[model samples]
Every structure is written in structure tokens, then in C-alpha cells.
Target: MNFRKVRHVVRREYLESVRKRSFLLGLVATPLMMGAMIFLPFVSEGLVSQEEMRVSILDRTGRYGAALIADASPDLILTLAPPGMAEEELDARVAAEVLTGWILIPEDFAETGECTYRSGSITNLAVLESLRTRLGLSLAGAKAQELGLPSEDVESLLRPAEMRTVRVGHAGAREGDFTQVYLRAVMLVMTMFFALIPTGQILMRSVIEEKSNRVIEVLLSSVTPLELMVGKIIGLGAVGLTLLGAWASVGVLLSLRLGTSLPISGGEIGMFVLYFLPGYFFFAALLGSIGSICSAERDAQPFLMPISLTLILPVMMGMAIAQAPDHWVARAFSFFPPLTPSLMLFRYAIKEPPAWEILATWTTLVLATIAMFGVSARVFRVGILMTGKRPTLPEIARWARER
Candidate 1:
């Protein structure tokens, strides 16, 4: 292999990609899009109308109606229904938008605790939850009064305890914020997906275009297929790293300006890099091989789908893995080479796994990446100049096995 030729190829690939308008736009747009996705819900919540919910109570037992009206919050306009008012009347009131909902407390309330809430639309979870909570507290107080407990003691007994969580770690103890940990894990996984998949596709498309244009023939005059492949991977991988670095810098600046600490630690960031590089190389080599065999983008999709699914499945299961980092399924998947990057990152975010497990997964991923690169190089060497029909699986396997 001529190192000089490889260097030239790497320089050319890097310069060509970084100079594109799309790449320039992506550097600014990607972070803004991710920021909007993260914070938009909170902004939307603030925009929600603070209209008071008008509700009526049809208390058949005649015991809890006055209590509900008294305990209702400022946002709730609660009123007792007229004596002997039919269920149809309440439904009509809801349909007319005269009431947000109507609560039915049955006559045998002392024996059966079931109640029904009827509304035209049941999608307002906040209002539903508030009503359920207040109703439950009111029922508990009524039962306490029946048991001859003092009113003041009932209030004290029904009050919820305030609790705080402290997470003890190697660095010492700090207040635990599950939301921060969850968001950090999601961000890390998304970062890997954005950095790896698109860059890999770019590599694949570059290879296909070069092959289709017979440009590889000219390049081969100076560099071996292995050199060309390695150079392209390194150059594009550098592009991905540049993107990650830019995002990380922006995140650090924002966190500093906002007087907030980063949710991720230095060690976790190091692990992320370790997993990220091999994961990129593995997929890049796979995509590069697929690109080598095909003449067009359409021809590549059949091969690309499985690889795409492998990356996506881990993300879909991310919540489960984070919730139970030490579960057998998560632990087992952490050792699987294709899933190691995302699943292991999730586990690390929730709870750092054993050192040997991390080392084992990392080693496995590195070995898989090297093996994949070697196979891809052989396939590329054979298929780069082939131009007629797309090769079969067996033919591709034969290419990899050949000298």
C-alpha cells in the first residue's frame, strides 16, 4: 500500500465532503432541530389555555357532593347536580359543552367504592388525574370520619410524604435526576445514529457513484483497493467526528451559560467514543461493500434494510434497556456486536456495568469491525470494476473468499 496515495485520497474525500452546502447547513440545522424536539413540548405546555374545567357531581348517596365542591381547586368549577337529575341530563350538559365532565357517585358508595366519570372527550389526562386524586382523598376522609377520627388527624394522615433521591457513586453522592440521565442517554444514542448512519450512506453513495462513473479505474492507477477503502473510511469518519465535536462544543457552551452541569461524566464520554468509532467503522465497511457491488442507489436498498433495522431495533428498545440495565436481556444484548454500542451506552447511562463486561463488548466490537473491514476490502477489490448486473449473495461471498 502506498501511504502517500492513501493520504491524497483521504485529503480529497475530506475536502470534497466538508465543502458541500448540505454539510454546512447540517452543522447548524441538526442541533437546532434536536433542541426544538427536546424543548418544544415544554413550550407547547406553556401555550395551553388555562381555562377552568366546569364539572357537576351527581351524588346519589348524598354524602360526598358538598365535600367535592369545597375541595375543588381554583381551576375547577364543581357544583352538585339537581336532585333526581337523570344521567341523560348530565350527558346532554357534557355534549353541550356546559360541563367538562360529570362524576357519578353511586348510592351504595359505603359498600362499593366504584365511581364513573363521563365526559364528551376523555383525552384530557391532567383534568382526569386531578379529579381522581381529589375524589380519592375525599372518600378517604369520609371513611375516616365514619371511623370517628378527628378532622385534623385525617388531613395529617392523608398528606403524602416528601421524599428525595440521592445517588451514591464513585465520585461521591449527589441528588439523583432520572430525567437528566434519561435525556442524556437518548441524546447519546441519537448522536451515534446521526453521526454513523448518514456518514455511512455518504460513503456508500460515493463508492457507487465512483464505480458507476468508472472513476475508480482512474483512482486504482495510483492506489490499491485496500488503500482506497481505508482512506475513504478514515476521511468520512473524520467528517463524522467533526460533527460530533461541533455539537459537543455547543452543548458545553450552552450548559455553561445556563449555569448547569453536563449530565454525562468524562468517563462516560470516553466510553461513548470507544463504542462510537467501532460502530461507525463496522457499518461503514458494510455499506462500502454494498456500494461496491451495486451500480445505483435503488440496487443498494435490499442490502441496506437489514443493517438499518439492526441499528434501529436497539433504539426502539432503549427505554426497556434503560429501565432494567442489569436485566438478562440487556446484559445479553450488550455482548452482541451489532447492538453493543447503543445498548451498552444505555446501560452505562443508567448504571455502569462491570468492567469486564465493558472490556469484553469493546473488544468484541473492535474485532468485528476489523473483520468486517477485511471482508469489505476483498469484495471492493473484486466488484469495483464490475458493471453489468448486481452480484448474488453467493457471488459476493466468493469475492470475499478469493485471493
Candidate 2:
């Protein structure tokens, strides 16, 4: 291999990629889009305030309306029914938009305590839970009075118990909330998973276009197939890193402002890069091999679909992974080279796996990446000039095995 020629190819690919319209648009839009996603909720909150919902209360037993009204948020305006006022009159008022909704306490309140809420507006879970809690407190107070229990005892019974979470890891047990752990896992996994998509597409499309246009023939006249493959992978890998770094910086700033600093350490970030670099090279090599074997972009669909689906399986099972990081199935998938980067990273954020698993996952991925690159380069050498038709799997394998 001519080192000078490989260096030239690398420089050309990098400059051509960054100078393209797509790359510039992505470079500018990615950070702005990430900033919007992070801060839009905060900006929109003050602009789009919800109007207070007015509700009428009909207490047939004359017992619970006061309790309900006391617990209502400022957003809920509770109007008690006047004595002798009919339910039909309240229903007419609701229909006339005089009230947003009404809560009806049945006459058999002491026996059943069954309540009906009538509203045209869709039910809000927060509001309904608040009303239920207030009703329960009022009924419990009544029951306590009947049992001659003190108000202090009733208050103690209603108070919720607190549970503090402590995450035990190599760094020792650190107290943190579920929100921090979940956010870290989601952010890390999604960043790695999504950043690979464009790089992989770029490599695949580059290979296909070069082959279809006979540009690979001209390039191979000066450089080996291995040099061409390595140049494209390195150049595109840099592009992916630049985009991801910008997004990560935005995420850190947003998280700091939101008071939920990401729980990932510098060591974790190092591990992320370890997995991502090799993982991207591995998948990109596989896609490049497919591109070299096919005559056109359309010819690659059947080959690409399975690889795309396999890559996406981890994300689809993300909730399961988070809930049960140590589960056998998650542990099994974490070892798979294609799924390892996202799945293992997810598992690490949720719950650190055993040291042996980490070592083994990386070992397998590194070996797989090297072996796949060799196979891709071999197939690429043979298939780059085969323009008439796509090759069969056996033919591709034979090409890969040949000297």
C-alpha cells in the first residue's frame, strides 16, 4: 500500500464530505434542533398557560364538598350547590358552559362512598388523583371520629412514606434519584444509536456511487482496496464524532441549567467512545461490503433491512433492558457485537454489569470489527468492477476467501 496515496484519499474524502450541502445543514441544524428540544418546554410553559377549570360540587349527603374544595388546585374552581338545587339544573349549567365539570357525591355516601364525575373536558389524572386523596382523607377523618381516634393519628396514617435510592457501583454507593439514572441511560444510548445512522448511510452510499460510476476503478488504479476502505471509515467516523460532540455539549449545558446533571463520569464517556468507534467501524464495514456486492442502491434493500432491524432491536427492548439490566436476555444481547454498544451502554447506566462481561464484550467486538473489515476489503476488491449483476452470498464468501 502507498502511504502517500492513502493519505491523499483520506484528505479528499474528508474535505468532500464536510464541504457538501447536507453536511453543512446538519452541522448547523443539529445543535439548534437539540437546543430547541431541551429548552422548548421551559419557553412554552409561560406562553401557554392553562385556564382554570371551574367545577360545581353537588353534595347530596352534605358531607364531602368542603373536603374536595379544600384540596383543589388554584386551577380548579369548585362551586358548592345551593340547598334544594336540582342535579338537572347543574347539568344544564355544565351544558351551557357555566361550569367546566361537576362532581356528584351520592346520597349513600356512608355506605358506598361512590362518586361520579361529569365533565365534557377530558379527565386530567393529576386533578382526579388530588380529588380522590382529599375525599379519602375526609372519609378517614369521619371514621376516626367514630372510632374515637386522635387527629394526629389520622394525619400520620395519611402521610406517605419516603424511600431513598442508593446506586451501588464500582465507585461505591452513590445516592441518586431514578430520574438521573433514567435520563443518563436514555441520553447515552440514543446518542450512540442515532449518530451511527448517518455515518453508515454515507459509507454505504459512497461505496455504491463509486462502484456504479466506475470511480472506484480510477481510485483503485493508485490505492489498494484496504486503503480506500480505511480512508472512508476514518473520514466518516470523524464527521460522526463532530456532530455528536456538538450535541453532547448542548446536552450538558441543558442538563446543568435544568438541575439534573448527567450521572455519567469521564470513565463512562471513555467506555462510550471505546464501544462506539469499533461498533461504527464494524457496521459501516458490513454495509460497505453489501454496497460493493450490489449493482445499484435498490439492489441493497434485502441485505440492508435485516442489518437495520438487528441494530434497532436493542432500542425496541430498551425499557426491558432498563428494568432488568441483569436479566438473562439482556445479558445475552449485551454480548452481541452489533447490539453491544447501545445495549451494554444502557445496562451500564442502569446497572453496571460484571467486569468479566465488559471485558468479554469488548474483546469480541474488537475481534469482530477487525475480521469484518478484512472480509469487506476482500469482497470490495473483487466486486468493485463487477458491474452487470449482484453477486450471491456464496460468490461473496468465495471472493472474501480468495487471495
Candidate 3:
């Protein structure tokens, strides 16, 4: 193998990919989309209409109506029901949109402790919850008064307890909430998954295009097929790494600016690289071989679908894996090469596994990746020159077995 020729091929492939307009646009757009996904909900919440809702309370007992009105928020326009107003009349008023809702307290002396709420739309959960809370608080205060206890003591008893989460680690305890940690872990896995698929498809399409245009013929004259293949993989792998580096830098800057930090340690980043490199090469080799076999993008879909589905399987089961990182099923998946990268990273994000398990999983993945590359090379060498209808499974197998 000529190292000089391989270097030339690597440089050519890398420069060609990074210069494309699509690549440049994607470099900027991906992070913006991710940021939107993260922050848009909060922004939308703030933008929700703050219009006040009108509500009428009919207190047949007349004892709790004043307390309910006093406790209501400014956003709620609470009023006493008109004396002797019929229920049917109130329903007509609600249907006419004069009142957002009306509450009725039974005439019985608080024996059943039940109330009825009627509204044209019960879908406004915030208003419904607020009404329930205030009504419950008023009833509790009345009960406390009857027992000769203070209303403040009853109010304090009704307040929910606040709890803080602290994660204890070898480095010491730090405040880490589940949502932040989960998002960071999911982002890491998503970055890897998204990066690999596009780059692998690019590799496949590049090979098919070059073959169709007879560019591969020109290149093979200067370098062996093996050299060309290895060079392309390394070059495109570099492209993926470049993308990841840029995104990581952006993430760091955002974290600093927003005063929100990801709980990712340097060791986690190292593990990501270890899994990512082999995972990319494995998929790249597979896609490259498939590209060498087919003459068109449409011809490649049947071959690509299974691989794409396999890649997505772990992501579909991500929630389950996160919830039970140490489960036997998750542990088993971490050793399966196709799932190892994403699943292991997900599990590690939830809770770091023991050293021996990590070592074993990495070893299994690397060896499988090596074997896949070896087979893909054999198929690539034979199929790169073949043209016509796509070959069958047996034909591809025969190509791999040829000496």
C-alpha cells in the first residue's frame, strides 16, 4: 500500500465534503434546531395569553364564599352568584360565554364535603387546579376554626414539602436533576446517531457516483482499492469528528452563557470517542460495500433499510434503558456491536457501569468492527467494478469469499 497515495485520497475526500454548501448549512442549522427544541417550550409558556377568567360561586351555606374570593388570583374574576339564580339560567350564561365557569356548594352543612364545577371548556387545567386548591384551602380553614386551631397552621399544613436532589459521586455530592442529566445523555446519543447516518450515506453515495462516472477507475490506477477505501473512511470519519467538535464547542459556550451546565465529565467524552470511532467505521464500511455493489441510490435502499432500522432500535428503547441501566436486558445490549455505542452511552449517562463491564463491551465492539471491515473490503474489491442488476445475497457472499 502506498501511504502517499492514501494521504492524497484523504485530503481530496475531506476537502470535497467540507466545502459543500449543504455541509456548511447543516453545520449551523443543527445546533439552532437543538436549541429551539430545548428552549421553545419555556418561550411558548411565557407567550400564553394572560387574560383574566370570570367565575361565579354559589354558596348556599354562605360561610365560605368570601374566603374563596379573597384567596383567588388576580387572573380570576371571582363573584358571588345572584340570589335565587336557577341552575338552568347559570348554564345558559356559561354557554353564552358570559362566565368561564361556575362553582356550586351544596346547601347541606358540610356533611359530604363535595362541590360541583360547570364550564363550557374544562380543558383549562391551570384554572381548574387553582379553583380546586382555593376551595380546599377554604374548607380546611373553616374546619380549623371550628376546632379552635389557627388558620395559618392549617395553611402551613396544606403546603406541599419541597425536596432537593443531590447526586453523590466519587468526586463528591453535586446538585443534579433528572431532566438535565437525561437531556444531556440523550443529546450525546442523538449527536452520534445523526452524525453516523448522514456521513455513511455520503460515503455510499460518493462511491456510487465515482464508480458510475469512471472516477474510481482513474483513482484505482494511482492507489489500490484497499488504500482508496481506507482513505475515504478515515477522511469522512474526520469530517464527522469536525462536526462533533464544532457542536461541542457551541454547547460549551451556551452552557457558560446560560449558567446551565451539562453533567458530562471528561471521562464520558472519552468513552463517547471510543465508541463513536469504531461505530462510524463499522457503519461506513457496511455502507461503502453496499455502495460498491449498487449503481444507483434507489438500488441501495433495500440494503440500507435494515441497517437503518438496526441503528434506530436502541434509540426507540432509550427510555427503558435509562430507567433501568443495570437491567440484564440493557447489559446484554451493550455487548451487541450494532447497539453497543448508543445503548452503552445511554446507560453510562444514567449510571456508570463497573470498569470490567466497560472494558468487555469496548473489546467486543472493536473486534466485531474489525471483522465487519475485513468482510466489507473483500466485497468492495470485487463489486467496485461490477455493473448491472443488483446482486443477490449469495452472489455478494461469493464475492466476499473470493481469494
How should the candidates be ordered by lDDT, best one leading?
1, 3, 2
Top candidate (lDDT) = 1
Listed per candidate, the RMSD to the true structure in angstroms reads 2.2, 3.4, 3.4
Candidate 1 residue-wise lDDT, 258-294, digit = tens: 9998767876798889899999999999899889999
lDDT of 2 by residue, 1-403 (tens): 6677777877787788888999878767755664475457646754433567888888887877776677666777888887468889888988999998888888887778788888876546656777777777787777776788888997787676799999888867778886667666766766676678677877888889998888888888888888888888888888888778877787799789999856577657977898898899999898888878888888887777777666657657877877777899998887788888888887888888888999999999999999998898999888877998788889988998998
Residues 195-294 of candidate 3 have per-residue lDDT tens digits of 7887898899999998899898888887888899999998898888888889888879878999986547776797799889889999999999999999
A best-first ranking of the candidates according to their TM-score comes to 1, 2, 3
**What is the TM-score (0 to 1) of candidate 3?**
0.84
Runs of candidate 2 exceeding 4 Å displacement: 31-51, 82-100, 111-113, 121-123, 172-176, 249-263, 301-309
Cα lDDT for residue 14, candidate 2:
76
Q: Compare the candidates by TM-score and give the number of the best one.
A: 1
Q: In model 2, what are the clashing residue pairs, if there are any?
A: none
Pitting candidate 1 against candidate 2, the one with the higher lDDT is 1
Cα lDDT for residue 325, candidate 2: 79
- For candidate 2, the lDDT comes to 0.79
lDDT of each: 0.85, 0.79, 0.83
Q: Which is the winner by TM-score between candidate 1 and candidate 2?
A: 1
